[model samples]
Target: MTDDRRRRGLEMMRQVYGWEVGDAPGDFFGITVDHLFADIWSRPGLSMRDRRLLLLGVLAARGLNDVLDIQIPAALANSELTAAELREIAIFLTHYVGWPLGARLSVQIDTLIAEHERKRH
Candidate 1:
């Protein structure tokens, strides 16, 4: 259970996404410990696209809009989703979660998208 692979994944998550799996609160600590991270994320069985689908649900369930703001672009960069696809998801989520939330999320997504374009230049 405790191994270098687990440690590496935890560290990489911290450096890349600022996800501190070690200092996680009681909420996430027991829910998704190193075992789950190693078993699921490290597995090659599912494609990144499928992984994003699951992550989206998790995000929505937790009402973590800010995190998803960052995540949508990441999903695109990882080839898990396209810009158009993300737009569609936003549209659909808006209907379900209310426009106010969607609007806020859209603003964040737009910033990320613009930053991405600028970085390419």
Candidate 2:
């Protein structure tokens, strides 16, 4: 992969994950950095914040709670989402995603919001 791709990927990772991309974890990280970020995400269309918000919805719907933990907090920290908007997503999803999954996501989002607030000070 080119140095330019690596640099852009690192910047996107920091913006969305709130951390630097460390030395490659393996081929997976390499592909993610080189292809996913540098190629796909670089395409002109959705903003970074738009991508993040859509990802949050998918993670919540799929019960990918661990990833949601990372994304929800990062999204808020990056100002890609507000606490209120996240809460609203949970509520709106209740009808489509069902109550049990939505309730769990709502709880997790609340916890993440609290965590983000605590880190601010």
Poorly placed runs, candidate 2 (over 4 Å)? none
| Clash pairs detected, candidate 1 | none
Worst 10 residues of 2 by lDDT: 14-23
How high a TM-score does candidate 2 get? 0.93
Q: Candidate 1 — which residues are off by over 4 angstroms?
A: 7-33, 43-45
TM-score for each of the candidates: 0.66, 0.93
Residues 11-109, candidate 1: write the lDDT tens digits.
Answer: 645433434546444545533546555456667777656777777656754579777876776775666677667667667776766777766656666
Model 1: residue 9 alpha-carbon error in angstroms: 3.3
TM-score of 1: 0.66
For model 2, how does the per-residue alpha-carbon lDDT over 72-114 read when each residue is reduced to its tens digit? 9888878888999999999998777788999999999999999
lDDT of 1: 0.64
